[model samples]
Target: MARSEEQFKKIRDQRYEEISNAALKIFARKGFAGTKISDITSSINLSHGLLYHYFKSKEEIYVALITNVLELFSQAVEEAESNNGTPYGKLRWLTELTFKGDFDVALDRHMLLMEAMQADFLSQDTKEQIIDQYTTALKGIGRIIAEGQQTGLFRDGDEMELAAYYISLSQGITLWNAKGLYPIRVSADMVLDPLMKRG
Candidate 1:
């Protein structure tokens, strides 16, 4: 009997996800330039040849990792949007949703992907794809902020600038914690305090 297309897709996705999860851990630990395909295969207890059946190279794995992170982040925002709230409330929900359990692991993977964006190992097309993904994510957040402003739920300001600032702030916190320069004692409430007070 032949496998159905849906079943094939399910198996393919499962294998890809396994490879990506292993790559995420290795990349987070050793960074993009330092990580090797062998490292990913070893982490998952798979032979290099079997790993290559799913991903051709480390660059492809890095791109897959970035794509996965963006999808997860987008899903987090979407889930937060479903909660009862005004636009500002939704934004707050989204911000807090990002820091929930296992988010630190995702954040670490995100930082390594960002570092890879600066490397020559990534092709120009891949770099552009990553940037486009980030820009789309930022614009999605900006749109929410704009909606809040229009509804008078959030204070008036340059929505794009505000969105960009928030993204930078989140990334800064991730980087700071990764460096061990700051303790992860801060709460989402502390980060949202200013926005809440202004609204």
Candidate 2:
């Protein structure tokens, strides 16, 4: 009576995700440099050797968590960009989709992101890769804004600046959401009113 191969694989993947989730919270509070594999291991019931069995090192876990978050962000932006519709529609879609106060932009999910921005200890290569993913997101926002301007749905201006403006707004929502305000769901329209076209 041995476990089937598929059952073993399922159990392995479940433990892998459990480790990743525990690691994310530690990374959020301690920052990557301050967090060790033991810190992650101690927080979960799993033994020390079990964590290492799945991930070779803290760096591997850090990258896995970050890359997963980046993929989610990238997919949302990509969907907005590829939509053959009005720029205003795309802009609205991106804003609503991201700041919905769920996993997509939850402060917990992105706590690593805010900390990483000021993390001077990270390797130059890691920092560049993070910024590169963020920049791709910015470009997607820019396309939506550029379309809005061309269609007279928005005022003409620097698209990147506009892109930054929108992202900053979402960040503000995320920050407030972290404090239990849940502003994104309640005040999204009020928060975004100033930016939308008046006519």
Clashing pairs in 2: none
Q: List where candidate 1 sits over 4 angstroms from the true fold.
A: 1-15, 78-84, 179-182, 196-199
- Please write out the lDDT profile of model 1 over residues 1-199, one tens digit for every residue: 9999999999988887888777888888788778888888888788988888888877777877787777777676666556676776777777776665465584666766678668687789878887777777777788877887787665678877888777777767766776676558657656655444261
Off by over 4 Å in 2: 101-105, 181-184
Question: For every candidate structure, what is the RMSD over all alpha carbons to the true structure, in angstroms?
Answer: 3.3, 2.4
Which TM-score value belongs to model 2? Answer: 0.87
Question: What is candidate 2's lDDT per residue for 91-148, written digit by digit as tens?
Answer: 6777777766464336766788776656687678887898899889888888887887
Backbone clashes for every candidate come to: 0, 0
Q: Estimate the lDDT of model 1.
A: 0.74
